[model samples]
Target chain A: MAATMNDVAQRAGVSVKTVSNVVNGYPHIRETTRARVLAAIEELDYQLNVAARNLRTGRTGIIALAVPELSLPYFAELADSVIQAADAQGLTVLIEQTGSRRERELEVLSGARRHLTDGLLFSPLALGDGDEQLLDVDFPMVLLGERLFPDTVDHVTMQNVEGARAATEHLLGLGRRRVAVVGVHPGEVVGSAGLRLTGYRQALEAAGVPWDESLLGEAGLWHRSTGASAMAHLLDSGAAPDAVFAMNDAMALGVLHELQVRGIRVPDDVAVIGFDAVDEGEYSNPSLTTVDPGREQIAETAVRLLVEQIADKRGTHRPRRVYADFRILERRSTLPA
Target chain B: MAATMNDVAQRAGVSVKTVSNVVNGYPHIRETTRARVLAAIEELDYQLNVAARNLRTGRTGIIALAVPELSLPYFAELADSVIQAADAQGLTVLIEQTGSRRERELEVLSGARRHLTDGLLFSPLALGDGDEQLLDVDFPMVLLGERLFPDTVDHVTMQNVEGARAATEHLLGLGRRRVAVVGVHPGEVVGSAGLRLTGYRQALEAAGVPWDESLLGEAGLWHRSTGASAMAHLLDSGAAPDAVFAMNDAMALGVLHELQVRGIRVPDDVAVIGFDAVDEGEYSNPSLTTVDPGREQIAETAVRLLVEQIADKRGTHRPRRVYADFRILERRSTLPA
Candidate 1:
């Protein structure tokens, strides 16, 4: 059986109330009495009931981070960063995987676990139209990602369009026309895919290159396999391109692999660039060129915003939106250094 | 302000006690009354105070999964599997990242958050020496990985030695004379690195190939960068190896990238195999060949054992040690099909 306050009190030769006072850090206790109580508690290994204490304090000292899934290296690394940021503030993080599903994302915002966590750092990938009002909750929450922009909640996001534009312009600057794009979600207007596609079109217009629908490689989920399949589809459809702009690094790596499998040389036959400079890209064959989306800044800013809301307690602070700066990281996949 | 039981009662035209009964799912409540209470709850968006309910039931519908960190692909994939398994059992998982540090690992077992979770699924990477006594906690825990073996707790591990041996033997079967191993932690006898190195040596001895210490690539962490550097070190030391056995898939991918950078052809020049069949391996340049350590089974079995302990309530069930089966997944990295 686990030790209780009564066990500690009995071991310390004191009353239950005295032991409780010592455990709760009451300042009126004598030094000798506190030391004896501490020794007894350590000897018995008594644990204070955090749930009961939470009822009085209205704080759980824990935060929830809701991401799509950990299998994706981006989200996994983001979760790692959030945990480190939270740890610096002396808070624990609980992770929730929404699987990029609409229903699960709604359930997360329903405040079902509000009693257990002070606030949440939520990144919604499946919430689109008609989900704005649902984002407004009584509990403290800081939204992560470039999804919804509800004025009632704080949001931390990256420079999606600017970063993607920079990546596409980097390819165009290398004198590469007929650039192909991978991981395009048809009809998307707000998510990463849509914003990035817009940037690609802008870059093409600036370079006086015509936009060809044939060069757009449609893919779903943005996984590596999907990227490879998309590349195959583009090639099989006879859309010969001089360059490829993959939406993310995972897909970029996949595209590189597919090209290598076909014996097509990178930067010589086709140049490739991706967004989200994940660690794997640094050691990939040809060393992938990608955009660094300021993941660390996003993690830190989201935690800071969530902590602010938690401290306000009244939810009266006007919701703020913060965007992290991004940069292009040039590597061998684009051109020879 | 959040809605309370009184607000729900007022909206439903019922007493607070009746609302409480309906919320608690009492069978004695009338259907119409229950429907009215439920309607009020839906309209007001009221949530039950889970903390108070947990105190009464002595259970929290939440479990914790503690891993080294999510940045590593292996641990990220493992966390993904565990989350899916927990979801199937209708349990929510709260993740804790220990950063693979000994102090943090000890803190996780110190029962600091015991009141907030019903059980813990711990995968410690740094706990060693005299830390077995710390594993004897009063809470329900199922240890994951091969880091520790305590008689008092259930354990779920992969076939580290056997899997590594199969990988080495596969490379040797390709008529490769000198086999190099990556991600070796020297003079260790327990962890994954140590056990895998042992398997590599055993395979060499069984095949009548002399053991060459020069081919053992020392790496602190089994990350891709480390793996690439280890491969570089082996090459710089003039170890002309025909085959390489990387400890994990991430490192194997790195080794492939390193070899490609040096204009070395895979399979024709050096055959490579890795452990941990990660998803990224499927899309690598040569499509990595690795050992499938039954990750899905490990996740499912660990959750089953943990749920059983939670159900037992009295902690009377004997502990169990389960080893997931493993198999060699031959791909292009090994040899021509």
Candidate 2:
């Protein structure tokens, strides 16, 4: 059997309460007593039974990551980065594949396993502005995304507007007008795609280029196949955009594939740019010019913030919004340079 | 606040002890009492506190998937498959990245979370025959991979030997006598590579072809870079192998890249085959001929066995050594169909 607190206490010539106090970092334990308990614990290689301790302290060194889907490389990459960050902090992640379900998100939040995790890092796809009640959850949580804008909870977001703006500006600076936006969320104006759409419009307005509704290609799923189909639609309309801005790298890759298939020269007939610098973007046929959303940094920051909040009382820390930087990662698909 | 057991008991018009007995699924409880307790639970949406339940029943529906690394696509895919299988059975996974460190793997097994999981699915890379004590852990676990052969534990493995034999046989059937093996591990005769290496040797012996150690390429890592370097080493040795069999797809991709760099046509110049049908293999330039080790089947089988063992203590179930079927996926990189 594994060594127990009673065993350690007996070995150290101390009471079980004294050993518990030392383990919990209580202030009253004498230095000698603490040392004796520590030595006994070390000698036995005692691992505090988190299951038992969680009953009293109500904390498990586990966290949940609710993401849209892992089949998509972007979310997969983000999950990887987040897991790495969590590993560095000596925590484990319970990944929940939401499959873009709002009900599932709520279910996961209220599951009995919530007691098994210190906090949750939720990335919502279906939950929107009206779901502010999620912020009122008593457990420690860090929100991640552009979909929901509750003011009471901590959120880690990227500069989607600015990043999309830079992507569009990059295409326009190359003297390409009539740019088509791929993977748009219909009607919504705050999600990742919606914000990028706004940034696209802003860029066109700044460049004295009219934002044509015809140039917007609606894609419910930001996948490579969708990007390809959207590009096919845009090309079939004969309203040839001088460039294309795919909201994500997967879609951008699809667009590139479609262009290559139809004998259309990239950067000659149409320049292309994408967002969320995926690793696959670096290995595409001609490579892809995209925006780096600072995924790695955001992951690390979110973990650090959630860990801090988890280690404190509910009202002890003020909720703060952290916005990571976005940069234009210029590659082969945009201009000749 | 969440509804309490007292509230549930009052709502069901039963004693709290009776309610507890019903909630805990006491075999002696009447059907009417059980129905009322369940109805009350549903009405209140009262999810049981798993932490408390764990202390009473000593079973947590969580399992740990201790993998070598997630940065590798293979591990990531394996994790995804494992989670899917586990979720279907109403279980959650707590992922731990061991980075192939034996200490980390053993630490995770012996950690406090051992009480938090129903069992463990351990994939050890560094822990060899010497770490046999792991099989002695006082908990239920299903081992994955060929790193261990302890008769005391249940092991779910792929047809590495037979699959490698088939792959080498496929290359030889293509009239290629000189087949080089990439990612040859050192002093190992029990892991995947070791088993596959044995298969390769068996195939050579059966074919009346001499086994040449000179064609062996050492790759410490089963990654693309390692594959590429190993292929280069083969080329630099002045003996040009007619075919190459990479132990895994990542290494196979690297070999393909090296061939491309050297203007050597795949299949035409040298037939290439890989093991572990990673998704990327299907999309490679010439595509890739690899062995499908039935990863999905392996995952599902392991999960079913674990959940069965958890639900029933007739625990006298025989320890199973399941070797999944392997198939040679014919792609353009191999001999013409």
The best candidate by lDDT is: 1
Task: Give the DockQ (C-alpha) for candidate 2.
Answer: 0.40
Relative to the unseen true structure, what is the C-alpha lDDT of residue B234 in candidate 1, on a scale of 0 to 100? 91
Give the deviation of candidate 2 from the true structure as CA RMSD: 3.7
> Per-residue lDDT of A43-82 in model 2, one digit per residue for the tens?
9988777678777777777889988776577777788889
* Candidate 1, chain A: TM-score against the reference: 0.91
Error of 1 at A31 (Å): 6.5
Interface RMSD of each: 1.3, 2.8
TM-score of each: 0.93, 0.87
Show pairs that collide, candidate 1.
Answer: none
Native contacts kept (model 1): 0.83
Per-residue lDDT over B1-337 for candidate 2, one digit per residue giving the tens place of the 0 to 100 score = 5676888899999987887887767899888888988899899977666777676677778998888876566777787889889999889988887878778877876755777788888787877776677666666778886564767777888888899999999999999999999989977888888989989999999999998988898898787778988999899997699899999988888888788668787888899999988765655556689999998888888888777767666567667788888799998789563
